[model samples]
Target chain A: MTVGILFDMTKCIGCGACADACKEQNKLPGPVEEVTTAYTWTTVEAREGQYVRHLCMHCLVPTCASVCPVAALHKTPEGPVVYDADKCMGCRYCMMACPFDVPKYQWDRAIPIIGKCIMCTSRVKQGEATACATACPAEATVFGSRADMLKEAKERIRKEPDKYIDHVYGLKEAGGTGVLMISGVPFEKMGLKAKLTDEPPAMRTWQVLSNIPDFVAVWGVFLYGVHWITARRDTVAHHEAARKGPDTIDTTHTGRPS
Target chain B: MNSTATLPAGRFRLGFWTTVFALLTIPFLAITFLRFSKGLGAVTNLSDKFPWGLWIGFDLLCGVGLAAGAFTLTAVVHLFNLKRFEPIVRPTILTGFLGYIFVILALMFDLGQPWRIWHTIIYWNPHSVMFEVGWCVMLYTTVLSLEFAPVVLERFGFHAPVRMIHRLITPLVIAGVILSTLHQSSLGTLYLIVPSKLHPLWYSQLLPLFFYISAIGAGIGMVILESYMSKRAFGRHLEMDLLEPLARAMVVALGIYGLMRIQVIVRNGSYADVLNLTYEGKMFLLEFVLGVLLPVGLLAFRKLRTSPTWLVVGAFSAVLGFVVNRLNVSVTGMERASGIRYVPSVMEVIVSVTLIGIGMAAFALAVRYLKIFPEEKPAEEPEPEGS
Candidate 1:
């Protein structure tokens, strides 16, 4: 039921229509930018003699969403990773954590917030294709249910093995992003992070964070146990000193009187 | 120096260093105003490619790490029942409290929306490492305040509150240690999300453990340095007997940290990267040599550990190493992947320096007014001549 986009680089004609439609749909200002910025949500770049679109990958388990201390960025059930500016304290942790370097900051504004593509969640929710997908004259970018889009991408590669690369870039990178890409050129040559682990990065941090309760429990008991044993030892030593003659001083104990 | 010592106790004096700090504060204030009015882009060299810079690297990471002495000493004195260490406890706690305060102050500038900092308390994101760090820091600062409260309360003759706090002292110390452990390690966990982005030289699954162990070494080093400085400034007797044992502890910490660093590099099969002699490789070597090998090798010998001069040198080297290591993780390790050569702006450096000056000034004021030292002797002797 989750919506998604599959961008076929081979079909992209370097027309820049998707970029224009994105700017217009988002109400962004001015001519289309050559690269993604806080104001520009998406950009089409020339790489390896082909057009490659750059924007938020909107991962299945978004590192940006997980790293956000204020829950400003989160994955919607419908498929997109959305951002809430009101909840954001502008820590910029999202910008730091995003694997794709997707999140951009309004760094010039006095009251800045994070800016990134939200996967056109409003249009996707209305059962319509994203602005870029709708405007793709060559059918380079297509929107559909995630399951269907993934299957279609697989089918395309299987049907024309020699024409397409044998890989889907987002199918496993950063634990599988919602925006999948099938390219005729090798992903690495096209400037993609081709060697990222299949596992989500958030899980690495979670592996440590999940142990907090156990650590607190054991560490607390151990500290208290040490305190108790030492306190008893001090008391016993004090009593032994008392039993000894006044002339025999206990130089071993330097602790203050409890 | 002798004339200032002749002045009445509990009176603040404007010394040469104090005047220098005041002069430094002027630029910091102006830059701070410009920062807020024009935004972070105007004052810092940060970009979309490099979101963090010197502020997070030095001001927050190194500041918090150096302050780890407070928890370590408290646990040693209170939990382990080693009362010989009780003398330095109050000052360490004061340093920690002030260090955290300045960290929060630095954060106020780094954050694009400083006013909503409290949103961490309101908003819930248990999955976030930053959330855990935020909660632990907030709670630990409160714990530190309560631990140090007795010193202030007793000064003002607030006997009842002091006694009540004394009753709760053990629990407070325990809480402080627990909170410090969580956040100190969690700071490393913040980098876990950047496994690929951070260079292989610094990145490891054992980052949290590495951070924790190194913090212990730096904490002990800070204690040594603080004692030496206190002796020079106030003509206080050097606790050579106590510092000798702490030096030994520093040796053990550094040894463990060094061993772990090697183990990680070997396990990752990245020893070749260490010998690659690239920028990151050289920085890593520098960090290891300065932070670990030199300090450990210097302090491991009984003859050197017992010597005050050598002990101070080893401690300073270790502290410097810690700063370098943190910067390596925050800036150097990330440079190539970010594709931007990030050098902090002048205003950024000034802000960081001013924060340190403020911390030092605050410590001086506390030493003057508060009963930081157990043996209350007036500053009758002349200050020491050399560093």
Candidate 2:
């Protein structure tokens, strides 16, 4: 159904209620704070009294999913990019691949795994909104289908053109993320840095690696051809030397006819 | 058989490097214990922001690149039938085999769940760049072993298998070359997904090409450096005839790499903001100049390329600069997006050096026991047929 989130930064009240609800709902051990971690999946970054809640952007073609060796991080059909700790071999490549720097890690443990918002996949599957979205004191965080959220985001921007910046944060960044954000202030001013190509990063890898099979065939044939040609010449040279008398041909150390 | 064949001639010499190596290894063993027992957090400075460190950068990336001489020289001698270069084929293959082993060993420490590394084979995420690199490395390591098997088999008098390997040698080397090319470039593909995170100076569509070309240069440099060290340590006479042509070839390789790098940087027009002095700019300049331009210049001249001392100097510079290049790509290249710098811990340094020490010791052991160098005969008239 392509479920997604529409975070209206203008409506946010800079309260820690959403963060607290995320901690409670996810059963996270540590208290919620400005920075996220293994325990904290969501947090609010406040700049000049303007609040921007930080969590996974849940990209359409997630770089983390493409970079993972074991396919631990996967994007559900409904839209959340979820991580499986059981399948995770602790490469931490997802942590590096995320453009928004979303995924956090359990660096304190003997065996570490990454942490990030999964958009409450279990609850969302059961037709319930995310913990953070539901606990919002105001209608700042809205959960709906991606098409609906995108329509609402564009409508809000069009209705009050002067009141809002003429940009949707996740609409095109990193190849169109599932979560959309509209802010009164410029998104970058709220410390939400996400300047990237509209195309997914996975395409960048494939652009080069896709040529491998063709290269293998071409290179293999070229090498064999050279081997055959040189071997034939060496054989013919040996035959020519063998035709001469034993006293005439000097072939010691050559492993050829004497 | 002489004692030198059975054991290293200076078995009990216990030189200063030996003592230094021992000192580093003892602490490294202790650190490895803490790393496994207490976790990576106890010994490494790695965090969520900096997941990979010295182990992946130096040990895996640079280690693999430096060992490129194996496939490169093997193809030259076997596929192209360059008979003059035959003496170095085995040594390069041995170096390549040892380098992959070291990479696997380093991964045991870096992987979060080292035991599940094999899970990639079964899970099969073809979309993942790591998946492709993983399969290529595993397959290539196998190919390298088979390519090297004849040497070991011949040493131990296993003739039947040696003959079998001889028949299989051409195909084995071809497979090795293909696999090497795939993973070497795929290693660069790992960083392609981080275009936003990596500095534009290092990130580009042509990263794989740059990686493959630089690997060829690095491989040539490593062979030169290794040959010099072996000659110095084992008292084997240098093969001037072979090295002179090798130096000429290295110059061409480095020149090609440098040209491509310049074209990429100019096309990106990304690092043009060099007026504002930054650490990234400095590192970029260092890597480009010393690693590419300086070495190319050194080996271009006929006089310098022919002289063993000058050739070795150029090779050493290229190797050291290429090592820094890998570090720059992995760690320094991401400094802007990360907004944090990662310096290796003392324990990390100790472990890396100790691993290198172990690899060198293994190489030395092989050289002493195996027929690594061509047998040297005294320059004299042939013995009488009666004798």
Candidate 3:
């Protein structure tokens, strides 16, 4: 029942019509302020003779959800990385964790919150597709359950190997993003990062985290021992100095046995 | 701590409202207003590509790292009973307190919804590194306050509470030291999320170790700088006799940090990157040479280490080097794949400037009013020969 987008990049026309239709349906302010205020849930990035749609992939294992300290950004069971402004503390760590940089900040507001495509969950729940998918003149932006989309993508690639690159992004990257893509060219040439591991982003930190308790205990004992040894030595030095007359020990004497 | 000097007839030559503080506050106030009114964007030039700007890099990261001196010295003096270093404990703590307070301020401004800061504590995401950092920082700040409370009690002549606190100081100090170690290393762990984005030379599972070592080195350097500044500004004597031995310790720390830095680079198989010598390579070399190698070289020489002027110079170099290192990690090292570059706007600079200036002003006022430095007991009149 988890919904997602399956963008077939080979079918996209660099026309920016999807962007326009997205703004119109969402009642966005339009591209005039896309750099700041325009809410183009989907926009076309023309890179190296190919067009790519930049939007939330709605990962199956969302790094943004895991890293968010306040649970402001979350992944719904129905399959969307949803934003809750009330919960957002505005730390923006989620922005850093997202490989796609899909989340946008409403930086112009005095108390801004994160803004991102939520898979248009409201419309989709009513049995309609996302505005970008519905408005795509070329039917390039396909919508369905991720499982069905993945199956369809494999069929298309097998049916026409020459027409598609031998890759499906978001299948396993950052732990299997919901939105999948197929293109005619290499991903790197299409302005997408190549070679990211399929493992969850937070997986990188697990090693350090797993050993933290051990490190803390070992370091604690070592430091405590140093404190004890130094204290004992200082006590002995103090006693020996006390036995002698005043001024028996000097600064140079303390420098020894280091 | 107590002051032997009688109250001065007048204030310092350059008082709190000096031209520097005044000039600095203009930017600070302007930036503060804009930041609150227009959100962080109006003040900073940060974007989704570069979420953390200079404040997080400089103030919270580098500032807290340098301030590690307080607990390190506290552990050495109070816990280890090093009488020679006793003169430094209070001043070290004061510096640490001021530095940490400023870090919190910087963090507040950097956050988009400053109000949601409490959500970290209330919501409780125990699995996250940031959660650990947030909890540890808050707890440590509390511990620092408790550890520092005896000073205030002493100042106010609250003997009963002071005695109770003195008895508990050892356990409190141990707790503070433990918390500081966890959070300082956790700060470095924040970058583990961006393994690919962080320059390979700086990225490692050993990041926490590298951060801990460099923080110790930076903390020592900060103490030396503070010592030098106090001598120059307040006519206090330079603690060359104590600082000389400390310089040797600094050398040891720097040596280890340098070795670890190189080791991590090799272990990560980034040796070729340094040898190839691209822009990142040159900067990497610059951090290694100026921040690390030079200070280690200078401090390793016994004669140079003991010299007051040379020790101060080496300490300054080490402090700047650490600052550069932190900036490299938090800002310069990030891979902005979207080709986005951030140069903090004027307002952003102003806000950051204000925080530092206000911090310095606060430090100066505390030193003036509170017993920060140990009292210099005057020479007693020579007793009668037969008495």
Candidate 4:
């Protein structure tokens, strides 16, 4: 079963309990910052009088996993995209590719790896909710199977149309994220991108990359054909000069024809 | 007669340019030390908002694009069997080889976990554009090395190996061209994932095609500029006849690039953006005019194509334009979406300049010790009075 998180902005009270639990569970040091950084994985932003928690969307087909040269970042079966520090070369293509701008780098460290929320895959795999979800006192953040979460989000919006925006935030963004959100206010006002294509961004890169085999096959044959034709013509020209006379052959070697 | 008699003498002396290069290395070394010990934060303006900056844009993109002459010239001389253009082959290959080496060096500094660079080799990610580019670059550098091995072998009188390499030369050149075509275009494909993030004027589904075509133009322009500079430095003869055809080729490549660029812009329905004269629009116009229109106009005329001064001027303009285009795509195009302004730090600039200085020094040394240039037919010996 693919576990996921559903965050409801209307229910959140900006208590910062989830943020504290995240730091405690991850053993992250220092006080919680206003913004997400290498040390802070999640934050609650106060925007437009609504409390919005900012963290990794954990895309179904994560762009971070796709752009990595070394396959350091990958999606776990539990619905979280995880990172392997040992395999990471720190090219930062993932940071550049993530539409949500979730990934942060440890720029101050000589040897660094990317930092992002992994949706608490360890707890989810053991049939437990995420640290943030468990610590959420108001029940704003809930963890369940992706199907159940998406169903609840739709049900909530349908039952109280006036209380919601009539849409689920992550249902279609970046080809459907594992983390779902329903907000009374518009997503754009909460710092979420409203214009992201429903299709996965990785598919665009795949469109070009998939053509490599055909290109190699056709281009290889074409180059070889040109070489054969040129070599044959040069040979024929050489033989013709030889048949003409010794004088012509001498001049051909001494001077190139313009 | 001594073989050295035909060589250009006294040109490889330790002089003013060498001293300047040496002086520039001091700051680069200092910054490099700071970068490793104190970290990238101490030496660069890079942040999560601007993950990539001048190193990726100028060093990797511009360096690889300018080195395109190696594949282009190899195909022309070896595959096409254009024997008349053989004189410049060795030097062009040398420049291309050095270009790639320096690009890798620059990458080592840019990567945060550079020690794990070998993970790309062991790990496979066929879906990644970076994976494809990395493999192609590695294989192409090998192909280039083999293509150039014969020259080194000949100098040492290793006839067996030279003959073996000569037999393998045709296939080597073909492989080099294919590899180059893949990576040069793949570099542009890296930006394809950011359709929304990149500015509309620079973003297109056909980014790969644009990058490949512009690289061809820049490659030819680099060859022309290299020829002129070598003529000045080594006191060698300028092969105007060969360069004239190449100048025409540059015009055609840039012309096609310019037309396709306008077509893509129009088809994307962004023509209004072009007329609006916004910041992005202004940068796009500068890239188009400097890289395409100006160079194509200058080199289109026969008189200008034949004149060394005008030819070099046009070539320099084309090269400069190519640099601006890459920078626009990498930095300026993403700035609005990123909500951050990225300017290279002083240390970053020094590192780039130092890498270029190292390349030039390597090329000069290669020319001095190796048979880079064709022998100047020992200036027609004065006839004996009796004869």
**What's the i-RMS of each model?**
1.1, 2.3, 2.4, 2.1
lDDT minimum window of 10 residues, candidate 4 chain B = B378-387
For residues A1-258, what per-residue lDDT tens digits would candidate 2 score against the true structure? 899899988889978788998888888887786587778888887775567888899999998898888999999998999998989888788888888888877776777778899999999999899988899979889899999999999999899998788999999998988899998888878877767889998889878667777989998998899888877767666667778645656343233554
Q: Per-residue CA lDDT of candidate 3, range B1-387, in tens?
A: 222433242666866456777878766776778789878777788876788878888888887898899888888776676667988877788888888888889888988877778888778665567877777778888887777777778878988987887888777788788888888888888888776577787778778878888898889999999988766556566667778878787888889999988888888787777899865677688778767888998889988887777788899988988988888788767744446655677776777777877877776666677777777655422112211
Clash count for each candidate, listed in order shown: 0, 0, 0, 0
Backbone clashes in candidate 2 total 0
Instruction: Using TM-score, rank the candidates from best to worst.
Output: 1, 4, 2, 3
Q: What's each prediction's TM-score? A: 0.96, 0.95, 0.90, 0.95
Score candidate 4 by TM-score against the native. Answer: 0.95
User: What residue runs in model 4 are displaced by over 4 Å at the alpha carbon?
Assistant: A248-258, B1-17, B378-387
Q: Is candidate 1 or candidate 2 better by DockQ?
A: 1
Candidate 4 lDDT over A179-222, as tens digits, reads 99999999999988867989999999999999999999899899
Off by over 4 Å in 2: A243-258, B1-10, B271-277, B380-387
Query: B348, model 2: CA deviation in Å?
Result: 1.2
Q: Give the residue spans of candidate 1 off by over 4 A.
A: A249-251, A254-258, B1-16, B376-387
- What's model 4's overall lDDT? 0.88
lDDT (Cα, tens digit) per residue for candidate 1, span B265-370: 8888767867878888899989999899999999999999988888999999999999999999999999988888999999999899888888887787777777
lDDT of 4 at A165: 90
User: Per-residue error at A227 for model 1, in Å?
Assistant: 0.7
lDDT string, candidate 3, A1-258, tens digits: 998888988888867776776677666664723332215566787676767888788988777777777777778888878887787888787777777777778777897878777888778878788878887878678888999899988888999999899888888877888899999888878867676767877776666777778877887787778767766776666667667756765342232322
